[model samples]
Target: MRKLDEAHLCESVGDSTSTYFMKDQKSVTGLYTERQKNHFLVHSVACLGTEMHLAACPLEFNKGNATASCPGGVLPAVVSCIPGPLYTHSLALKKKLKTTTSVRLKGGTHQGEGRVEVLRGSEWGTVCDDRWNLQAASVVCRELGFGSAKEALTGARMGQGVGPIHMNEVQCSGQERSIWNCRFKNITSEDCQHTEDASVRCNTPYMGFHKMVRITGGRSQYEGRVEVLSLDVNRTQRWGLLCGEGWSTREAMVVCRQLGLGYANHGLQETWYWDGSNVTDMAWSGVKCVGDELALSQCQRHKVFSCQKTATRFAAGVICSETASDLVLNAPLVQQTVYIEDRPLHMLYCAAEEDCLSKSAAKANWPYGHRRLLRFSSEIRNIGRADFKPKAGRHSWVWHACHGHYHSMDIFTHYDLLSLNGSKVAEGHKASFCLEDSECQDGVAKRYECANFGDQGITVGCWDLYRHDIDCQWVDITDVKPGNYIFQVVINPNFEVAESDFTNNAMKCNCKYDGHRIWLHNCHIGDAFSEEAERKFEKYPGQLNNQITRK
Candidate 1:
């Protein structure tokens, strides 16, 4: 390689003939030149960008010509051909939404990290991790409205997927418009599994959105009263409380996303408990969002701020988390174990002591009459990135004499029977007395145990079992009439624990009851069906209590 002459370099390098020297794959604008060592001069070279080899282009070597030969001060030519789309930063990329075609990301806790999936025909499939690289991942990120990829994850780092393997051994020049534009091999049955799925972590642009707002007060940075930057009458920048009226999880979702927090654990209507900040004026009001906006400003808000609750305590607040546990029930196990039990009052001493029976049970004949109970085993699994832990630690755990155990969370799960219109017919709640890993996936060691007052939690990939025979695990249905009902179980019903996804936390089953016996069927996760399918499944035109607000 030889250097071009500085004097004539400008005229020679960027000439009309230089188009042949540039990689002209649409994104290429022009050649950018730089200096290099060990220079050799070449004249009249035409590459046309698609040459299989440098020898294919017409070129002449300056063997003995003094003018064409490298001078002592001259340097070799080095071109840093940057793509046209990349000249501008991410703000420019957001101006034009790039079409993703068939590629999609899945199972990611955050926005830019996920297992790569591609839609072929009507089927969605994963990409094999074979020969996956940052260049290929960058192509994916850029196509999906994000910046260059930060990491090319392999071996299902995000999580395994269930589908056919679409592509493998993908090769990219790091400038392709889409992953499909890159060279890839066809996948075979023996080639890969869901465990070998490819994933990517993208480098998102810093929007400084977090700086525009902040959470003040609360025990940690994740929980606080919401405050936004506003201009006062004097045109001075000030931080003021956000109005809490009509604020819900949807609004908080936008706030959490804007702050770069993982998710909204709770959208508190009032934050009087967190009094860390002195700012008291209600600066913004009438904020409502569909919930997918990147920032709070993007959501619909009032043109003129009007707040009914002007008190500082009435200010909006939020609890955010980077990672949270998601608990899903074993629906099949529940269906298999559901049964009705009529227990005599003599055996109800322990049940009555624990307050597990219905309210009407208090007036029942002592040690004589029997109470009808609906029993079912619940296998609550933590399928999230983090363990399902109690919000309160061990020091605050309350000891229960009857069960001979310490209850952690006030209420962990809700068991309810609902009519077709979404009205609750009966209800039962399980206080988290012993939240420990009763079972774990193969090769995964259990991290939580209830024995000897050990730490209590449902580790990721583990489940805590509450048997049907357990004292407080039954719903009292003695006063109920025989009819068709929806048996619903909601884990973490109060949002006491942070979770990556709360949508899948509920399981519903269709229950049929007669005067003598009960039947349960069609048990499944709440989000197991599509929106259209779910609407058809419930039949009744009422909002499901288990659904989380999403865009």
Candidate 2:
């Protein structure tokens, strides 16, 4: 039995429904001991209330080669779901959310210095700044648990700037452009622009996501996939992929011509007969095949010193090929198996991996690590709510008291790389939206009305990304294909709004209000700052809309 590896990723049977139908071993239901001394005492719950039919309980050893003693062996009443140290979750009150100093509230400031919402129980409620001073800022900062009072802000709301803006006069020793800006509030707004109302933002540092590759080997790992071409079944695929200069048996060289390697265009061609007669890895042009009964095995071994593919045929050998396990080499018909071994080898970057010498090689998109949380330093305008009333279809108006939709650098990868020359933005858009969709609604943002919502069979681009709201769980990524990237795109975040949000069509039907379009000439990651921010913005946000860890 092989031990579980990190790559052996598994999702927990998260819900009661799944757990109810599942076997006990799939989860650690209740803690079990080695033995049970007092059967009456152990089985007797609440004394007299205990059910008598102890034998009927589903109390049995979960798996083979494992056992618990008698009374000590009995299972506990609850699960032992402690991952690390048994640290119990506690309620923490903190006020680290503060906006930068440069910008100020544009209008009304009639309340205290500023207003803030605190997490009380399960709800977020506003806190009144009665003291309204440096002390108050300290309380807010300490409440948040970031550190001492960095600064305090007055006037506008920090987050969505919805509901009401309370808290009047406030002043703090905290620096300018911080949450400690005012000790008192001279402005007021039922719900106003970000400048007039506070947009409580906190400076969370940058964290980037990078795939971790642990296993690198020279030997090929066989993976089976079905390829659809101009014809349904054309067992033949033309191949040509050369190991870049210094890679072959020769020393360093810039170009292929620099080395004595043969055939440049048609780098290398490998043929595999699916007919069961010769479809073995050991028999492949560049590799040695493996067979059953090692003692009697006649398979020949080929040392792939340094060569590329030229041309190849796909034929099947033996009636039933000696194949690997279900994960890697399971073929359409077990008979259609292809041979690939996992020997140490250097992995190639996408540009190179695209052309593997193995004709049967198929690629998968790498898993993007996790996302870092950061605040957007922005000057937001006031917008009234969208008196949303469900329309004929399953669509409804999105009443955003103050919502300015924005887009990010939306990077998407497929399990299998999409065709470069001819892939649509729609497919990529679907993948991006599927991963990025924070709302979880069937139709978020009107089903990609934007020109770049990603078209089918076409290369995907940035304009295609939807405004995914918060921490997104790519939980089940059946939509993702692992392999080389189809390409990349960066849509102008501001200008692409009306195009992206379905529930939001410029009410009067115009985009003059799209303020930043002037700064973003062509929807590419504009400046160094924006580029850095784009890289930091993650698919997921913190649970409490709190700050993400700064890497």
Candidate 3:
């Protein structure tokens, strides 16, 4: 039976008398019934080679006598075995089951550190902190295409998890293919909580490269002044600024990627805007990069490392990104705050000096026409991942003595009252705005402000809320007659600053007026609804008789 099994025989059939001639007496002592004998032979042969079922294996029946019929009238039965293909289907199935699962870090600014989550089946869940250590974390780091673990964190340092706790008390030997292959306890509701979620900071090679160079004084990681660390003859490490006299976007790309911030948007040679830091020593100068190097140290530099000007103002800055920022208007505030007011000509001197008045106001005689203003509040928010910075630097900002502030960009928002035929009846413009963080979400603090000569720009996760009471937040509608018109407000109209999207920057409202008062309703975001929905919104009948008067 063992030899037949090794031969890969599928099945065999024999009569009961054939068992007497077997070499091993103990192996072939089954029941003597014809059906039972046939079943035993078939099953024994099938189970020998690859454990195949009897029905799946080929069977050969032996009906002829062994010696052409015994001479003494005693017939001898023959035993025959047949072979089939080997049963090796489990090998392919095992390979299929060994595919790696998805893994990622959550709530981290960069890629190498965060709360660890593994995708199981269809849901993504967190790992518990029980017995979590660097050995287990190394497996996770390697599984995620990074290096070994630098630190295995606990107590939810990366923020709390939201889904099920997939694993607990994980014990890895530091050589497993994945964290899943390591021994772990299956988690139950009582086993863990999100506050005890396991996290890891992987030891990435790029991190060492990033540590060799850094950016400082900018609002976010994407935009900052460049600084590099140098080792002296004694092997002492010191941080110093890079001379920005000849810095270009090509050089900036290498700096940003070396710091793991993706690609470069703009490489600034003179970054007075980011000069808030006090590090002023210049180390390397005349850096020439092809934009493909992994580290700034690999780039070409001047042989003598001399700088024409060593001031911090000549420091290099970079704007790194995979995409640009996206600016959007707060549509609800525009509808609720629309009103018309009359201002005397004497109060319009500041608006005229800042160029906030219409084009005709520039040529108007002194103190002649009273400016009729259509005023509303606007809340512009930077919803992108990066801050919205002005393209112009501090030197380019125009100082307005009338408002006592500097305008960074010439045109920020556009206000227009259009006729039914889309002709501009009266238009208003907001001069270069002083971008500041008016409010922010929870856990975020305001960083930029227009007051006290502070840095002006909208930070990420922050909004600039222009109240209705602020000066010059009105449209000079003094030239338009009392009639129905389309009130449109477009934020970031000039696109002087880069943004991820510009399609959602405009908002429109239906307006009706009778010279003394005005009514605005059905204000909505320009890109929030479909074109058909917008057409329906515009087709709604306006109540021209109703007027909400404001003094």
lDDT of each: 0.74, 0.22, 0.68
Q: Which sequence of candidate numbers ranks them by TM-score, best first? A: 1, 3, 2
Encode model 3's per-residue lDDT on 203-231: one tens digit a residue. 55323678888898898878889989986
- The number of the candidate with the highest lDDT is 1
What lDDT does candidate 1 reach at residue 490? 94
lDDT (tens digit, per residue) of candidate 1 on 391-492: 788999999887789999999988899888889888888898999999997767999888889999998878899999998798889988998888999998
**CA lDDT of 533 in candidate 1?**
41
Candidate 1: regions farther than 4 A off: 1-109, 115-152, 159-198, 202-208, 215-226, 231-237, 242-254, 264-293, 298-321, 540-551
Decoy 2 TM-score against native: 0.18
Model 1 clashes, total count: 7
| Per-residue alpha-carbon lDDT of candidate 2 for residues 1-551, written as tens digits (9 for 90 to 100) | 22211111011212221111111222332223311212212222221111112232223332433223223334323222211111112223112223322222211111111235432222222333334444445434332322233244543233223222344444554432244344555334532333343322221111110111010111221111111111113554322222222121111010111111111111112223222122122112232222111110122323343434322232111111111000011011111211112211233222123222222123333232221111111111112111111111213212212222222223222111123333421121111222121121122242223233222111111111222222121111123333322222222121211111111111000001111110111111111112223233222111212322211
Highest TM-score, which number? 1
Taking all chains together, the TM-score of candidate 3 against the true structure is 0.44
